[model samples]
Target chain A: MLATTIHGPRDIRVEEVPDPTIKRPTDAIVRVVAGCVCGSDLWPYRGENPIQAGATIGHECIGVVEEVGGDVQQFRPGDFVIVPFCHCDNTCAHCEAGVQSACDNLSMTTSGQGELARVGQADGSLVAVDGGAPDAALVPSLLALTDVMPTGWHAAVSAGVAKGGSVVVVGDGAVGLCGVLAASVMGAETIIAMSRHEDRQRLATDFGATHVVAERDRAGAKAVKEITGGVGADAVLECVGTDQSMGTAFAVARPGATVGFVGVPHGVELPVGKMFQKNVALRGGIAPVRRYLPELLELVLDGRIDPGRVFDLTLPLADAPEAYRAMDERRAIKVLLQP
Target chain B: MLATTIHGPRDIRVEEVPDPTIKRPTDAIVRVVAGCVCGSDLWPYRGENPIQAGATIGHECIGVVEEVGGDVQQFRPGDFVIVPFCHCDNTCAHCEAGVQSACDNLSMTTSGQGELARVGQADGSLVAVDGGAPDAALVPSLLALTDVMPTGWHAAVSAGVAKGGSVVVVGDGAVGLCGVLAASVMGAETIIAMSRHEDRQRLATDFGATHVVAERDRAGAKAVKEITGGVGADAVLECVGTDQSMGTAFAVARPGATVGFVGVPHGVELPVGKMFQKNVALRGGIAPVRRYLPELLELVLDGRIDPGRVFDLTLPLADAPEAYRAMDERRAIKVLLQP
Candidate 1:
């Protein structure tokens, strides 16, 4: 099977690898029908995140079950499914509490960015696609339900975005664009997207962003304040995990508002005193993708949201290197790979 | 007028001070009938929080309105009220959102711990006690409503303590004991109080703690886990703002749980990575005392909760120095001062 592997910074390659097999009673072997590059992948590609030698990358996929261990009861061979980023037994207290992302028996199986990957805790990790294999046109959107879309939804829900409320999105990546769409779906009245790039800004608008502020730093926060008449947004979605993005999110939120974040944090220190003074609540972390899959899948199936538009570029799995390069160079909002 | 003043570290004195008079149209001069030393007061008393020479001290007070400026409409002379720690206009967006503690025209009126304290934003800062001034026996209870009781309620509410949920109180101080009471009032089925002191433990039990874990640090969290059958508490109220208490609060909370904190944070840094991985949310800051005053006051008046029991010692205004010393030496749970 062909799999994506990284040897060092900017050294992604698609190479022949041994096919995966179900190694545990709770495991299932998946033939990935589709996979996509993630914003988080850029961390290691840019050398911002340390990488191990010959590590398989990527963590999002939609696939068909090829084989399942005897103990797997929820899925069977040829079953189309969305494999959430995190593998969990799904019966633990955490999983029961709708936070399977923090499942105690958690195993990360999506790191094997290959044509065939072994998924652990199959019963809990795999969400069978409704009505079997989706049409080719719906594949990208269905695949998105695996992570990005749910992540965006988590950001909105965590921020407590509600009907007639306002939200400010603090990144323009695919996740940020999805956040705009998610906030809209959640009934937010005003969705503000912060993007400096013209293309990303346009996509943000199409995704339901009512305003776009191209300025960075204090100026950007100032723009949000101005747009909201100096009251700031009701909720701020911090899709980027930089200190600057966190700062901007906090700066543009009105007193008593909340900032929900989903990007993996890096060097982020919450100014407790400032947060305390403003009574702003900072609430968000990893999105429990599995928790919202059912609702989000329904929305996607019903055509209520078109989050798949985030994938501006698509290529064969063999062009994995080009996909990474395009996203890293900002040439693609997100790249979809066909296996 | 007699007032409490801090001349230096560990140096408290009750001496003659100029009588407070209305300086703003929105101000009301309250003759403090009851005042109390707070856990936060120990910061400056022990020199942890620096104090200017001869700085007026004290923040918790229940008093009778002696005079009101022309613009004050909420109260007239002879009205008894609870003066929350913070003074705010109560009409700002933040106030309207039930976070009056973060009101735009916020004022720290508690600094002048004098008999005649002129309160700014009187209409918004004072919650008139139902009926007239109560008997002397109810003085301490009314004073508790000013800060400690509401602070505890904030911790429980911010942590989202729902009916039948479990909560862990991280400190055994008056605030922690009050948190135990607050959680019980909020309908928690399991309230775990973490305390090593016998008096506090007994008080915690009296305040409705279903369980008491006397251990500290990791062992403390382990005890909580044991109590919940390997799952942590559903809500953890952080009443001590130290790093150790913060760590314990986070450790004792299950994934998807929240830690509501009200202690003035000192040397506390939230480990974002750890919190992120666990899906634990940190949600509390300064309690908006004004927001919960009405409901809490009703609870007190209806005899549903007795938070004033936390004041184990009472002292006359002239003995203010003794009150500070008792709290600093841990010889008293709290000290009430009568002016």
Candidate 2:
């Protein structure tokens, strides 16, 4: 099997690796059909995050079960499935409470970019597609449910995006665009997308953003406030975890509004005093994508949403290095890889 | 008129001051019936918070309406009312959204411990007791509603307290004891109160704390986890605005739980990484006491709750200096002052 591995900064390669096997009774061998590059993947590629000499990378994928452990009851060979970024038993107190990201027995899927990957907690972590593999055209959308789409949905839910509410989505990356879509699906009447790039802004509008502000920092928040009729947004989605983005998110939130953050925090310090004085709330973290998988899969399969459009570039597994470069240089919103 | 004034740290004095008169069309003059020394009052008295020399200080009070300006519509002379610490117009967007603490036209009540106090936004900030002034015995309870009771209620509400849930309160001050009462009223099955003092623990148990943990820091969180069968509480109230208290609030919360904080933040920094990984949320701030005044008033009037019990000491108006000393020394849970 060939898998994506990183040796150092900007050092991505697809090299031959040993095939995965069922290591536990609850594990399954998945023959990955599709994998994608994430915004977070750039952390290591750009030297922003530490990395080992050589470690498998990638956590989002859709695949077919090639083998299953004896204890795995819900999934079997030949079934198409979506693998959540994080694996959970789905029965622990936290998982039962719908916070699978904080599951007691949690493990992340790191070899998804490989031809074959081992998935643990098979019965609880994998959501199989009914009736067998669908049309090839729907593969990207189905693959999205494994991570980004569900993450965006979690941000919207955490922000309390309710029917007839106004929402401001910070960051116009794929995840932020998905957040705009999620807010729309949740019935938010006014969706504002903060973006500085033309291509991303267009996608944001197409994904249901009623207004797009290309300004950054204070100017951006001022734009959002003006659009909201002098009062700030009813809910804010902080999809970019940076000090500047978080600041804008809080600045544009009306009193009693919540900011749901999904981007992994990097040197971000919360404005506790402002949050308190304005009665603003902060919620969100690693999204429980597993909990939202089943529902999101249904939406994708029914054609109610087309989250796959976020994938602006596709590359073969052997071109994994190019995929990383494209995302790091902002040449693509997201890159899909065929294994 | 006699009023409490602070010249500097440890310099509380009862001095002659000019009587308050209606200052604006939206203002009302109230003759103080009862004013209590608050946990926050100690901040200025101890010099932890900056204070101007000879400044009148006090924000919680129950009084009879002395006079009203032309624009004061809801309150009338001779009517008894609870004056929220923060005065709000209650018609602004934030107020209409139930966050009166962040009202567009907001002001703080600074002369509450005086014989006569001028309250701004009278129609919005004052919640009068129906059918005129009640018995003297109920005055303390109504006074409690002016700040502590509603602030505690805000903490519970912000923490997402639900029926049959478990709760942990991180402070033993008047507001924290009131928080225990608030959790009980919200139908929490298990209420844990963290207090080191015997007197406060006793009062906590009386206020409906099912369990009391005397440990501090890590040990306190450990005790709460052990009591909750190792999973942690469903909701947590952070009543002490310190780094240690905020840390414990998050430490003892179950995954996906929210920590509601109401204490005036001193030097608190949030653990954003831990919060993101564990899916814990933080909410709450200067409480919208005016929004909760009506409901809390009814509860106090019905004798269903006795929040005023937190005031364990009473002092004469001339003894205002002593009231401050008692609260500052932690010799009294709270002190009620008659003017």
Candidate 3:
């Protein structure tokens, strides 16, 4: 079996590892078909985040059930599935409240953790598609539904972007580009994408961004304000998870508008007083991807949306190091690794 | 007519001024039935806020219409009315959105401004009661409706406090105490009032606060978490508008809960990042007093609620300066000035 391993900062290698085997009743052994490097992945690949040696790094994957545990009833061998980033028990009060990311029995990825680990609640964590087996072309998009697509959907949906609302997306990574499509499919009258690079901006436009502003929060907020007759945008998706992006989201939203954020926040905080005075609603977190996967996949299957445009570089699993550097240097919006 | 004027910080005086006259078509001259010292008023009176010479010092008032201009058709020679701290035209888009304080035609009290100043959109700003005159027993309560009562209601309502929810209040001033009553009426099951004084705590308990925590934000947050199974309070009402009070409100509310703030913010800047991560909502501002005046008047008129409990001291209108001193020195929770 093959797997991607990180030895140190900026060092990734494809190595032979033991084949995955179901160890728990609630587990499923799947052969990774397509996995993508996330922007969040850069934090650890850059060694800014703590990582252990010889760890299997990818969390975003679309695979097939090679084998199912005794307790696994819904998923079966040979079924194509999308795996959410977080594993949850799915029966807790928090899960009932639709905050699956904050579920009581939640499992986050850790280095050295085996591939065939119990999904905690297998039926709830994996969503099987109706199609027999996803084609090579659909693999990237299906795998995207696991994290980025639903996360983008969550940003648009949580910010309450509906028909005829104006939406501004901050960040130009996979999630931000996907957000443009999400807002467009959600019926937003205007979609603004803030990006610097021409390639990402072009895809953002392809993804249904009505306007593109190269400026960051302050200048971006000004541009959006001017575009909206100085009232600011109706909904803003802060996908960068930085102080600047969050500030721009708050600034560009009109009084009584909302800003949805899905980026794993690093140093961002909310201005409680200003939000109160302006009646701005701030909502978003680690997305409950499973909650929105079914709808998102339907959109993908129906050809109403295409999120795979986010993948700029696809490579064999051996090129994980190049994939990490390309993403860190902004050479690629998203990279797909085939295993 | 006699009025309290602030010539300088700490130099408020009771002075005789010429009687007011109707100067505009929509203007009405009122003989003040009663006026009181607000905690916000203490800001300028104590020299913390700059005051121009001879500025009219009182904003919270109940008055009888001594005369009406030719265009004033609602009231004639004698009608008791509650005067909101904010004078709004009520015709602008902001006012139409129920934020009368942000109305385009809003007027602020200025030094040496005649009492016969126009009340724009008088129809919407003034709520007419059935009787030409109000009962003496309801005078204090009616005055409370003009600012503190409605302001407090705005806090709880904006905070999204509901029946059987837990609440924590951050101030022990008149508005804070009034918020306890408001939360109680809203059926908050657990109301925690943070007060250092025994008398104000007693009044808070009488006003419906079930628990009293004498700490500010950090400790208060811990106290609330200790009480609510480590989940924090369901809602927090910020009655003080300082950095500490704002931080406390954020700390006390659990994730996804709302914090209502009605205090006249003095030197408060909100922490935007922490709030966004915790998923707490920040709501409320200078309350739109006109929105709740009608309902509050009905409650007071029916004797179902009494807001006068906020006023623990009474003084003649001639002693307004002394009343201001008493409140500034923290000697009086609130002082009622009888004319």
| Number of the top-ranking candidate, with TM-score as the measure | 2
Residues A1-339, model 3: lDDT tens digits: 667778888877777766656666877666567787888888778787787887777778777777888888898988877778776667765566566776666764321112332244677688887776777788778878868888898889778898988899998899998889999998999998999999999999999998999987577778988887766787889898777778888888876677888887766656655776676767777777777877888888988888987998998777777888899999888998776
DockQ of 1: 0.69
The alpha-carbon lDDT assigned to residue A194 of candidate 3 equals: 90
Predicted candidate 3 versus true structure: per-residue lDDT over B1-339, tens digit per residue: 667788888887877766655556766666666778888887887777877787676777777667777777777666767777777766666676677776666654321112322244454566665776777777778878878998888889878889999999889999999899999999999999999899999999988988999876577778888887776777889988888888888888776677788886777766655655555656677788887788888888888899987888888877877887898888998888876
lDDT of 2 at B301: 82
Q: Which ten residues in a row have the lowest lDDT in candidate 1 chain B?
A: B105-114
Candidate 3: give the clashing pairs: A268-B273, A269-B272, A269-B273, A269-B274, A270-B271, A270-B272, A270-B273, A271-B272, B217-B248
In order, candidate lDDTs are: 0.88, 0.91, 0.77
Model 2 regions lying over 4 Å from their true place: none
In model 2, what are the clashing residue pairs, if there are any?
none
State the iRMSD of every prediction, in order shown.
Answer: 1.1, 0.6, 3.3
Clashing pairs in 1: none
* Model 1, position A254: C-alpha lDDT score: 87
Q: How displaced is residue B298 in candidate 1, in Å?
A: 0.9
Worst 10 residues of 1 chain A by lDDT: A104-113
Report the error of model 3 at residue B84, Å.
2.6
Between candidates 1 and 3, the one scoring higher on TM-score is 1
